[model samples]
Target: MADKSLNKTELVAKIAASTGQSQATVDAVLGGLFDALAESVGSGTKVSIPGWLSVERTSRAARTGRNPQTGATIQIPAGHSVKVSAGSKLKAAAK
Candidate 1:
């Protein structure tokens, strides 16, 4: 199976076409969505776009790991990472 792909321009065009809005408007709306996501993540808040996806933070406990190439033992400091989970509606739509 081949992977499907769509770029930002294609997405903007699709939104504009479907909403009968100007391309500029669609672009602005998309930009706002990205900005909101960034802000929410920065503030340590989960962002959920219903019928699309949810973005949240997950933590990793401190651990020891081996350096793959050098085979040297290293301590991996605990850290927080962002996780994105797809929503049920999106899963259904893709099927």
Candidate 2:
């Protein structure tokens, strides 16, 4: 069985071989897909790919925190984070 870890190059090669498409074409398509996903998620839009994954921008409120090394108190500014969740199909595939 193939290893579970697949980087971009390996994934593109596999997809190209399976679809009988050129590696360049597959790479381009993947690039465009990533670009679109980032653009949407960065703009506070929820992106959902059925049976695959979902991504969204999440906001966190400002809060106080402690410095472990110095044991000092600090303020953590509010910030945004990206949340990615795997869909049902992905979960099943893992098993």
Cα displacement (angstroms), candidate 1, residue 81, comes to 1.4
Prediction 2 TM-score vs. true: 0.91
- Misplaced by over 4 Å in model 2 are 1-4
lDDT of each: 0.92, 0.97
Model 1 stretches with alpha carbons more than 4 Å out? none
Backbone N/Cα/C clashes per model? 0, 0
**What residue pairs are clashing in model 2?**
none
Q: How do the residues 9-33 of candidate 2 rate in per-residue lDDT, one tens digit apiece? A: 9999999999999999999999999
Which is the leading candidate under TM-score? 2
Q: Kindly provide the TM-score of model 1 when superposed on the true structure, using C-alpha atoms.
A: 0.88
lDDT of 1 at 3: 93
TM-score of each: 0.88, 0.91
